[model samples]
Structures are given as C-alpha cells and as structure tokens.
Target: MNRSSECITKDSSRLITTELKPPDISLVQEKSWNAAVQMFGSFLLAGFGMVAASLVLDVVQHWPVYEQVSEVYILVPALLGLKGNLEMTLASRLSTHAHLGHLENCLSTITLGNLCLVQCQAILVGFLAAMAAVAMGWIPSGEFDIHHAMLLCASSVLTASVASFVLGVIMIGVIVISKKLNINPDNIATPIAASLGDLTTLALLSWIATLLYRSIGTNILLPAIIIIIGAVLVPVCGYAAWKNKFTKQALDEGWVPVVSAMVISSAGGLILDFTVSNYKGIAVFQLVINGIGGNMAAVHASRLSTTLHTGQLEGPVISATTKLLLLMVVPGQLVFIYTIGYLKAGHTSLTPIFMLIYLSAALLQVFLLLIISHYMVVWMWKLGIDPDNSAIPYLTALGDLLGTALLGVAFHILYAIGDKDSDLGD
Candidate 1:
C-alpha cells in the first residue's frame, strides 16, 4: 500500500510540473505569426493602393505640358521620395511614441512639434530636390535653364507644403485608429503614409506644375515671390526646429536619414531620366515596383524599430520576428507581381519573359532590403541610436536604388534571352 501511494504521488508531481511549465515558446510563435499577418496584410493593401495611384502617372506622362518639359520626369522620383521620406519618418516617430506609451489621445506637444518639423523639412527638401533634379537634368539633356529650374522648385515647394499638411493629418488619424482597434500602429502607419504620400504628391505635382506653367508667363512676379517666401520660410523654420527643445530632436535625428534618402532618391531620378525613353511603355510598372518595394521596407523598418524599443526584439539576430517578416515577404511579392502583370498586361502586351524578369527583380529587391534592414536596425540600436529615426528613411531610399538597378538588369536579361531565342528559331 505504501509503494502504491509513492507511485501515485510521483505521477501527480510529474503532472504538476508539466502544467507549471510556461508555454512561452508556442505563445511567442503565435504572436509573431499574428504580427506578421497584420504587417503583410497592411502593406499588401497599401501597395495595391499605390498601384492605382501609379496609373495616374501613366496619364501624366501623356500630358502635353509634361512632354514639353522633359526635365519634369527627372524631378518626379525625387519629389515623390521626399514626400514619402517626410511622412514615413513622421509615422516612425509617432509609432515609437505610441510603443513607448507617450502618445496621448489629443495632439501632444511632441506631436505638434513633429508636425512643424515635417512641414519645415518638406518645404526645405522640396527646394533641394528641385535643385538636384535640375543639376541632374543638365548633365544629360543640357536643356533646362533658370526658368525651368525655378518653375520646378516653386512647384515642388508649393505642392509639398500643401500635401504635407493634408497627409500629416491623415497619418495622425491612422495612428489614432490603430490604437483604438488594438492594432500596432508600427505595422500600418508607415505603409499607409507612404502610399498616400505618393498619390498626393504626384497629383499635387501635376496640378501645381500646370498651374505654375500657365501663370509663369502672365504673372512672373508670383513665381519670384513664391521662391522668396520659400527661401525665407526655410531658414525661419530651421531656426524654430533648432531653438525649440521639443522640435530640435527631430531636426537632429532626422537630418541624416532624410538627406541620405534624398541623395539615393536623386540617383533613382537619374535612372528614370536615362531610361524614360527606353522604358516609356513600362513607366507605370517601374513606379509601382519602386513604390511598393520602398513601402514594404518602410513597414519592416517601422516594426523592427518599435520592437527594438519595446524590448520585444533584443538584437538583430534572426529572432521569431525576423523570421516572420522574412516569410511574409514571399507571399507579398508573389501577390504584387502576379496582380501587376494581370492588370498591366491589359494595357500593354506582357510576354512571359518580361513577367519573369519583373518577378525576379522584385523578389531580389525585397530580399536585399530585408537583409539590409536587419543589420542596420541592429547596428543603430547597438550604438544607442534610435532606429525609428534612421531606419525607415534609409531602407526606403535604398529600396529605390536597388529597385531601379534590379529593374534595369532585368530588362537587359529579358532582351538577351529574347535575342537568344530568336537566333535559335532562325
């Protein structure tokens, strides 16, 4: 009877031990899977929305005014990148605040300060992007004069200022909505902000350019005044960003990422300038590919930044979060490539070779970005720097460069393959 009691006691102890063991591993895997789904879904939806916006670029390409000024194409990518950089950075900053439990229901001091900084950065960066485009255009075309440069600069500043305000409000609203829904703002905010930025900036650029073109001849004074106002406002805003304690951090933390993104984006603009003639047929596709890649990178960066801040991810090692994000990339890339091919083929004949090339380039770009984002986020966090301030802008800008380069290579490969097939058939 004592032996039987001992056996039963031992069995009970084993059962209690089993029950007491934490389900941490399984629980973590489940959470990571859910986070990955939410992020991938949000970015996929945003990417599709960007595709619809890119169709408008197709229309703009055919416009008489756009055709008249060939330099406008050189400015397009840079301007869009600037707008996206500003908004994505804002989203990242806001997401970090939300993760840290610093965000309030109303417009906090930090929120107001960030809004001011974004406006200032938008106007300042718009002016610089215009100048850069003019310089880049001069290298290839030698057709742009001060009149053209001023027009581009004025238009960029005006359009960016307006769009910044509108999109800023929308981004804040997204964060608020995400919080109310018990969703992670980091997952949704950057992608949505980036897509909206692309659409609004492109539409505003077209409208503003047309209006500026029509008015330049009749009211020369207006353009000069606008330029002067932009010149004055930049310094004033800079001073405010520098002087105010609340806004100074933004200026300090944002300049490197923002500037780096602009430089990289300018390279993308140069690519567009050189290849616009050759790839005119695939203009919309090119824009969509770059925009989607950049948006995806921004999403990943934002989430990684938040995770690092919240201590959910301690290092850059391939944690469950990293695994989930990488896995999410596969389905997202497949959906985007297939959907784009189906929709775009309706307008232009897309051969199997071309589709294969597009898919290859997109996959390569996303994979590269994932690796870069992991290392960069980890490195920044290790150095005690805020990844939120740096990661999104750097990743998005690098995405533009990689996306453009990969697309060019894909085109060449397709051509080479086609030539070989023709030769064999002959």
Candidate 2:
C-alpha cells in the first residue's frame, strides 16, 4: 500500500524466470487416476497411524492422571495445532496472493511492515485467548497453576511468532519453488500446511514443554518475557532489511530475503527455547489462541482480497459464500477439535457427545462458510479480481475457528435440553 510496495508490484513481473523447471512426475507430480488411488491409500494409512498413537497413549499412561496433567499440558497440542493451522493458513493465503500477483512485492517495505504489525497483534491476541481458555475450564484445573499457565502462554507467543516469521519465508519460497518445479504454489500451500501443522507441531510442542517444565517450574516469568521481547525484535530487523537498498532489488530478483527471514526465525526460536527447561506445565496452550488469530487473519484477508477489486457492495459477500461452501462445508477439520477435547480430557465416552454436537454444529457452520464464500465470489467478480485458490484456505481456517465456537454452543444447548420429557426424546 506504500510507495515501496507499489514499486515492487510494478516490477513484480521481472521476478518470473525465463527458465522454468520441467514437470516431474514424482513428489511435485500432478495427479492422475493412479495417483488418486495412491493418495487415498496413504490417507488410509495415516488414519491408522493416528489410531495407533491414541491407543499407545491410552494404554501406557494412567489415563486419568495423564488427562489431569494434560489439562495443563493439553494446551500445547491444541495450541500447536492452532499455530500450525495459522501459520499454514497465512502461508497458503500469501501463496495465493503471489499467484494472483497481489504479492508482487514480497520484499517491499510495506509488506514487511504489515506482517510485523500482524505478528504483534497475533501474539497479543494469542496471550489473551490463552487466559480465556484457562478461565473457561479449558486448562487442567488444580494440576496446573497461574504461573505455569502464564509461562506457557508467554512461551507460546514467543515460539509461535518465531514459527510464523519462518512461515513467511517458507511461503515466499513456495512461490519460487513452485515456479522452479512448474507447479502452482497456490495449490500446494494449503493442504501441505495443514498436514505439516499436524505432524511437526507435536514434536516441537513436546520439546518445549518437557524442557521448560523440568527446570524453572513455571516461575521463569522474567526470562519468558525477555525472550518474547527479543523475539519480537526479530521482526523489527526484518522490517529494516526490507528497507535496505541493497536487498531491495533482491525482492524482484531472487530468494535472499525469504531465506533470511526463515534463518532468523528458526535461530531466534532456538535461542528463546533455551529456557524451555524453566517451563512449568502445558506451555503450548498459547498456540491455540494464536492459531485462532491466524485463522481470523487469513479468512478476513482472503475475504478482503476478493472485495478489493469489486465495484459493488455484493461482490465480496458472494465470493465469501462460495469459498465457505467449497472448503469448510466439505472436508473441514472437525475431527481435530473433538480429538483435542477428548484426548485432553481423557473422556473417550465424551468424544461421542462431542461428535454429536460437532456434527450438528457443522451443519450450521457449512451454511455460514457458504454464505461468506458466496459473498466473496460475487464481490470479486464485481471488483474484477481473479478469485480462486486464495479464498478456500482462508474460509476453511475461519470455519474451523467459528465452528469451534458453534460446537461449544451446541454442546451447551444440548446439555441444557437433555432428558426433557418431550416427543423428540424417550
């Protein structure tokens, strides 16, 4: 939106390489009927792996103690899932922006400034959300303390921000990599992101929680805050780098800033994590809140994109509706939320109730996703912007957040009406 960003946008076309990579039929490979079969097979295998993990966790541990301990610790998984989702969502959305030429100036000052502001806002919101979750009976009640929760939340903010910073680089890299592979990064970012979120978040969260809880026992508030401050400064350096004249040409030229952002983010995260030994309990709960913020940013940003070029009021509204239906209404991540609740509570029976409630809530959620996507589609058409890959990830992520709320409400309502002596019941 600023002068520097505009310059990047004008010169964006120059970033395209005259030499594109030849299509490979392996990993970056396109799909055929055979590939579809293989994909489905892999998905089946992955589901079994999930079941096996749950079983192992269920068998070896004293389930109730684990649940109680997890009430404090469980935040890590959900938060990890959330940040994972958020990072992926934003990355995917940005990838689409690049595909659409909206991110022509990936190295522009304005872009860096915008991301820096958004990252801070995300951390703040994540912290508050962690507090709210603790208050709402989401955290382990007596097993964890305010100090533990505080440390966890603080660390989560630091860790997630660092992850997000790296994600920006990965996202930008995705575009370049896509061009090199003769594939569309727009298509690759979303699904790959969600999958990666599910996978790596567990390991990262476990390492942080184990280390932090072992040493300072959650009293390292000072260290936690200090690390967070330093982590925030990492982005400041990013903003400065984008403004430097030497690197200004690199935006339209190649992959320097993207790599730099990633390296800085990863290294900063490792340094901040040195205090992981001081963490008391359940440190990752903060990621969930951040994840939600990520979802909100992605969904709204995508919706915003669809509306930018539309000349009429209805354009965004319509486009939003279609995206909602296509993504959230179909294969939205309902299973993950219920799993979080069930796994943390160690109330496997409650999972069925959660299911009933979640499914019912999904119906309404689908409607919401549909309406918003519809609004966005029409809006984009009116605005004259090409609206496609971007909106789906945004809408899906948003639907996850909204669906969580809706499912919560549904459970509350169902509980309220249970055992009523009406014709609808026994």
Candidate 3:
C-alpha cells in the first residue's frame, strides 16, 4: 500500500507540473503578442510619418533654397538630429515621469519645468548645430561668406526654436492622451516626436531658410536680428529651468549626450553630403533607415528606462523587449523600401540586389543599436543616471551614424558591382 501511494503521489505531482507549464508558456506568448500589437502599430504610424517627411525632403531637395544654399544639405541631418535629441528626450523623460506616476497632473510643475528645459536646450543646440553645419559646409572649401553664414545660422536656430516649441506641445499632448487612454507612452511618444520632428523641423528649416536667404545682403539684418532674439531667450529659458526644483537636475545632466549626439549627427551629415549626390534615392532612403532605426532604439530605451524606474529590470525585460524590437526591423523596412521604390520609380531601380543590400544594412544597424540601447539603459540605471534623458540621445545619434555609414557602404557596394543606378535627382 505504501509503494502504491507513493507512485500515485508522484504521478499527481507530474500532472500538476504539466498543467502549470502551458499557462506559463501561454502567458509569455500572450504578453509578447500584445507588445507586438502595441509596438508595431505605433512604429508603423511613426514610419509613415517619416515617409511623409522624406517625401517632403525629396521635394525640398528641388527647391530654389536647397539649390542656391548648398549648405542646407549639411544642415539637414544636424538640425533633424538636434530635433531628435531634444524632443525625443523630452518624450522619453515625460514617459518616464508618467510611468512613475509623477505626471498624474499633466500640467504639473515637473511637466512645465521639463518643457522649459527642452526649449532652453533647443535654442542652444539649434544654434550650435547651425554653427557646426556652417563650419562643416565651408571649412572644406576654405570659403566663408558671412552672408551665407548668417542665412544658415538664422534658419537653423529659428527652425530649432520653432520646431521644438511646436513639437514640445505635441509631445505633452500625446503623453497626456496616451495616459488617459491607458496606453504606454513609451511605445508611441518617442516615435511621434520623431515623426513630427522630421516633418516639422524640415518644413520650418526650408521655409525659414528661404526667407532668411532672401534677406541676405538686403540691409534686412533679419538674420542678425533673429539671432539676437534667440540669444536673448536662451538665458531667459535657462533661468526658468534653473528656478524650477523639478528641472534643475536636467541642467546639470544631459548636456554630454545632447552635444555629443549633435557632433555624431554632423558626421553623418558629412557622409550624406558626400554620398547623396552619388546615389539615386539616397536622401530618401537615409531618412527611412535612420528614422526607423532611431525610433526603434528610442522605444526600447524608453521602455527599459520605465522598467528600471519601476524596479522591474530583470532578465525577461532584457530579452523580451530586445527581441520584439529586432523582429520589427524586417517588416518595417519592407514597407519603407517599397514606398521609396514606388516614389522614386524612375530615379531608383528596385533591383533584388539593391533591396537585399538595403534590408541587410538596416537590419544590422537596428540590431546593433537595439543591443547598445539595452546595455546603455542598464548601465545608466546602475550608475544612478536617468536613462530617459541620456540614453535616447546617445542611441539615436549612434543610429544616425550607423545608418548613414551603412547606407553609404551599400551604395558603394552596388557601384563596385557595376550596378550603375541613377544618381539622386535624376
């Protein structure tokens, strides 16, 4: 009887184990599916926004301002990158704040303080990005015209200032609405900021440049006047940020990532400047690859930061979120590649070789970036730094570099293989 009872008990224990395993497996699968639904949806929206932005860039490339002001191409990535660093960081920070329950009142002092802080950073970075672009544009040719310099500077700073303010407001609204709707702002906020960041910044940049360029040497001093106004507001925004207890930590932190990101993006701009003229659809594809890669990394970074803040940084998050982001790259890139092929039909041929190279490059770029974002968030949290502010800037900047470099290499490979494609604007 004792032996029979022991066997029965063992059988029952085995049955229980078998019974529990399915639910555990199903639970994980369910979570992953839900995450896919959320993340992919938001990512797609952001992707389409970037597509629109890219089309705008394509059209803007033909504009008189773009043709006359050769420096505008150099300014494009720097300014857009500046936008990513500022607004996406703001989105990430706000998402973290919301997740931490600190943004229960969206208009709280913390929220407003962060807004002020971003505006301040925008003015400063915008001006600096302009300086960097102008230097990069002119230093190579050993020609520096003060008139062109003023046009570029004014256009950059004004675009930065204006775009940041507009996007800052949009980000706040997105976060607030997402919170009210029980959505993860981390999933959507950074991408939306990115989406609008590209379109808004580009539109403003083109318009502002055209306006400022026309004012050059006209006794307008409009560019100079605009610069002075931006300069004056820097200290004003700074004081507001410094005075706010909630945002003072911001002033002390985040500058390294922000400024470093600008420099890195400027390097990508140089790459674009060099390669954009050589390959057909390079400009269009550059934004798609860079924007998509950056958006994915930012999403991952924001999610990781939120997890760390919630004290849930564990093995599952590290593996699961990273996997989700990686899975997104292929499908997302397919959509973008197709759209670009359709739009640039005559100018860019959709050869199987080119498609393969493009997808392979994007996958590798996003994979490395996602991996970097994982370690970066964990490292920042371990070091007691807020990953939300620091990680996105670094990760996105790295994405820009990797995407630009990789895209350039892909084009070069095609060229090496005698795949003579049409040049840009053909």
Candidate 4:
C-alpha cells in the first residue's frame, strides 16, 4: 500500500512539473515576432531618413517667403498630411494587390488605374488644401489678398502634382521590391512613403512657393492665370479618371477616406494655429512629431488591415503581432522625442518634467492609434468593406490631430509643473 502511495505521489509530482514548464513558442507567435522585428527595423531606417529630410525645414525657416508669409507654416503640415494620405492609400492598395497576386507586374491594368486615380486625387486635394490654408491664414491674420491666395494655390498645386507622380512611382517600386524579397510591403511601404512624402512635399513646396512669390510679384494676371489653369486641370483629370472603370472604382474606394483625412488634418492645423505661439522658435518640431506619429500609425493600420483581410487576425483583440508592434513604439518615441528635442531646443531643455510630458503624450498617441486601428479595421471588415481602403488614411489623419493636441497638452502640463517647482524652490 505504501509503495502504491509513493508511485501515485511521484506521478502527481511529474504532472506538476510538466504543467509548470513553459510551452514551446508556437509558429504563429514566431511569425509575429519576425514580422514585428522586420517592421520595427524598417521604421527605424525610414525614421532616420525623415530626420535627415526634416533638416530642410530649418532652411525653409530661413527663407524669405516663409518668413514673409507666416501662413505657409500652417499650410506645411496640411499639405504634407494630404500627401501622406494619398500615398498611404496607394500603398494599401498595392499591399492588397500583392496579397491577391495582382502585383505580378508594375504595368498591370490595376496598377495603372490606381496610379491615375491617386494623381487625380492629389491635384484636386492639393488645390483645395491650399485654398483652405489661405482662408485659415486669413481668419486670424486678416490678410486676405487675391494675389497672395493665387500664389499659395499655384505653389500647392504645382508641388503636389510633381510630388505625387514621383512618390507614387517610388511606392510602386517599393511594393515590387518587397515582393521579390518576400517581405510584406504593408509593413514597410506606408512609413517610407510618408517620410518621403513629408520630405519631398516640403522641399517642393518651398521651391515652388519662393519661385511663384518672385515671378508673380504684384502681377495679378500671372497668378490669376496659374490659378485658372490649376482649377481647370482638376475637373479634366477627375473626368478622365471617372471615364475609366477601374480608375472609377479606385476613386470610389478612396475619396471618402481622403475627405475624412482632410477634415482631421485641418483640425491638426487648427491645433497648430492655437499652440504654435507658445513654443516660439520650435514650430518646426511639430512637423517631425506629426510625421513620426503618422508614420507609426500608418504602419500599424496597414499591417492590421492586411492581417485582417488574410484571416490571420480577427476581432479587436490585440494579437502577438500588435503587442510586439506596441513594444517597438515605446523606445522609438523616446529616441525621437529626446533626439529631436536635444537637437532643436538643447539638452538642457530636456528637463525631467519635459521628458515626462513628451513621453506621456507620445505613448498615449501610439496607444490611441493602436486601439483606433484595431477597432476601425474590425468594424470595416464586419461591414464588408476593405479595411485597407480606409484604415491607413484615417489612422494617419487621426495621428496628426492627436499628436498636435497631445503635444499642446504636454506643453501646458510641463509649464504648470515648472511653475510648481519654481515655487517650491522659492
């Protein structure tokens, strides 16, 4: 009986040990880690590119056109945000095409159709964003002049037309390259496109704005002619796109998202309008923060949408892939915030309170983006809509709005904390 009891006790102990042992990592989890690592690495590389490109903003700040037309500052983020919106949509469409085996050739009908659609959207939205920027500038500054509006509109349209064509081609190339390498374009394309979009848009906007400012000096006819040409070109492109069935489908899938993004982007500009004075010389940092946040959210939205479409992810629960993505955000936000802060403001300006406020705002931005992407993708899927068609644009737009608002809040919080600290010291 004692021997029998010993055998049972030993068996029970063995069972306990087995139960306590960690399970081998599943294939799904392994894939999630691999995907996360690949995406995080790509984002880091793209981010460095954006940082280098953003130095152009310092040059822009020194430009006479920028200084003379402060409204251009407000227009900057809106224009870049719109560029990102269109390119992000293109990336999503390409990613979906890749997954569906339609990306076998760059010159495929679907690819051409989508390209035409994006270009048309770019022309229309660029013109409108510029006109809106003029109005936004007029609201507070009350410096509404037809020549100034025409110059701004002309600058926006010309820059956008060129940038969209170039960036769209680059994104298609990225999709092809990612496919050849067996990497997910969805993971890499949107962020890279966004970074490139910001850089190229800013550079082009500055060059075109300065050139227009000089060329049309007190000449209403030249500016008026340019604006008229821009206005006429929009409907012509739209009509052409509408006539093509495939392009029409692409436009149908893309326009609402674009309009929604514009609304959200305008809100971001409004936030900048209200809070930029508080930060004084550091207004350029807003572009960096918005670009980074928007890029991160775009990556997440693109990946999540792809996974959802592929049946690899379901519902709104955070997957291992998402957890790994979120883990990447923590260090990335810290590095960007600290590095840019030091470079722009100074190391001494990065006080603990400032760090805390910045980190909190950034982390909160990422967190909100993740949650928003998850739910938005799931809801679209349930509605029989393609999340790829809508998710990235919405996420990016929301990222801009949220990033701006959060930064404003962070600034206020830091000021209050500093005041409290000074009182204590006194």
Local distance difference test scores for all models: 0.71, 0.42, 0.77, 0.70
Q: Pairs clashing in candidate 3?
A: none
lDDT of model 2 at position 331: 35
For residues 275-365, could you state the per-residue lDDT of candidate 2 as single tens digits?
Answer: 2232211122112222322333333444344233222243434343234333332233344444444555222223455456545565566
Displacement of the residue 268 alpha carbon in candidate 1, Å: 4.8
For model 3 the TM-score comes to: 0.84
Question: Model 2: runs farther than 4 Å from truth?
Answer: 1-71, 77-85, 100-122, 133-146, 217-222, 225-368, 376-398, 401-426
Give the Å error, residue 53, model 1.
Answer: 2.6
Q: How well does each candidate superpose onto the true structure, as a TM-score?
A: 0.81, 0.49, 0.84, 0.82
Q: Which prediction has more favorable lDDT, 3 or 4? A: 3
Q: Model 1: what TM-score?
A: 0.81
**lDDT digits (tens) for residues 1-426 of candidate 1:** 333222111222111111211211222234665677678877787777788676888899888658866677778877887778889888987776665544542245556666677778989888887887788778887565777777888888888888988998888788877777777787788888877888889899988888877886788777678778877877777777665444565677778888887777768757866655554444555665777677777777776676665556455455565566557655776676668667753233456666667777877787788778888887887776677767888888888788877876776676567632321112
Better of 2 and 4 by lDDT: 4
Candidate 1 has which clashing residue pairs, if any?
Answer: none
Model 1: ten consecutive residues of lowest lDDT: 12-21
Off by over 4 Å in 4: 1-30, 139-143, 217-229, 243-246, 272-289, 311-316, 346-348, 419-426
Best by lDDT: 3
lDDT of 4: 0.70
